[model samples]
Target: MPLHPFLSKTKLYKFLKTICKPFHVVFKYTEFVAFIDENRNKGKINDYYNKSTAYKNRFQLHDKLLEELKNKPIFYYEFGVAGGDMIKKWSLTNKVETSRFVGFDSFEGLPESWENKKEGHFDQKGNFPDINDSRVSFVKGWFQDSVYKALLDSEFNEQCVYHLDADLFSSTLFVLFQIFPKLKTNDILIFDEFSSRDHEFEAFEIFKKCTNNKWQFEFIGAVNNYRQVAFMLK
Candidate 1:
């Protein structure tokens, strides 16, 4: 075996990792800032709104999105349904009997530490959401364990509205990769934490690149300082 490969499997590698750990956050953040600058004009978005007074109410942007979607039947997939608020809103907003809403989350919280939140920060004690609507349902467990299976069970070619709010890079990217192929023209993608540079922002940029120009999107709307954004496939 090669000496370097052998050493990499040893405890010294762990020791080296500890030494390099502190720089990881700083370097990734610097790269993120640079990424934001380079891609400032690259996306199709032109307008942005901050919503300073009611920064948390993203329903405003959702209402505007209704214009683009024209209150049509929605195949809405929400990746992170923490308190079940958004699902309820969508269920009530698009009452087209054909519209279906699916929410996915571990209900056990963040899969790993991101930003200032601990790994189990969003945990709901494994208690699933209670939504009264028949059109709404949820997939409980980590994205890796639940997403593919859910897609396999459901069939859809309708324009999908993917609300990626998983918070962590891994969760967000997994949903994007799985759903990107199933998306149809005019399908909408919404990012709840798009400004989390090292997490959601990074995954989205990577996802776009991986598609290799196979996809084109019109940046449609934004809320809360681009923290939440919508895009429509062309």
Candidate 2:
């Protein structure tokens, strides 16, 4: 039922928005849980889910990606490369010199507070990680930068593995919308903080709703209780 005309525009609703602000996160979380329940059963469910830490599950996903690609040259783009441990692992896992690995990070730290992590929580003093890989490079700036613009104008002729670890709803949504158009069949997409209901998970659900592109995916299984998950564009 629709709200009554008077209540619809009442200041009481505005007041409630201020007083009930904290529950907003809880509501978002609940919505995300429903999303997971709906989509988790799709495609394949690898046996490793919910049995290990997220870090280990992440490498497991990476190894699976390489195995599927047969270690071929590909494009790997990682958003939120704070200390770059995961990106570094990806570089070494695929030794193809022609494979390009690009990381996007402000390096200053988190642009905004996320849960218990305050702004600048992951501050690196603006230094890039020392990864000695010829095919690897860094885009040192916000996710919405020249690199994003370049991506908008670029083409991905080879297989692309996009790692969405931005850990913020705004950042994740920005990257998803930007790349949603360029995604090709069989391209891989990974989410490091996939279970963060108010962040990555919420963003993913919203992105699916807001886009008219009719993007379809192959669920490549989630690990660590859906904290780390992988999907394939279809």
Candidate number of the best lDDT = 2
- Name the regions of candidate 2 deviating beyond 4 angstroms: 1-11, 18-27, 39-54, 152-155
TM-score of each: 0.80, 0.85
On TM-score, the candidate that comes out on top is 2
Candidate 1 pairs with clashing backbones = none
Per-residue lDDT of 75-167 in model 2, one digit per residue for the tens?
Answer: 888899999988898888788868888888999999999989999989999999999887888888887774567686454888999999889
Q: Which ten residues in a row have the lowest lDDT in candidate 2?
A: 43-52
Candidate 2 clashing pairs, residues 3+ apart or interchain: none
List the global CA lDDT of all models: 0.80, 0.81
**lDDT of prediction 2:** 0.81
Model 1, position 113: C-alpha lDDT score: 94
- Can you give the lDDT of residue 84 in candidate 1? 85
> Model 1, range 114-214, lDDT digits (tens) per residue?
89999998889988788888889888988898899899887576778899988889889888899876888888899888878778988988998998967
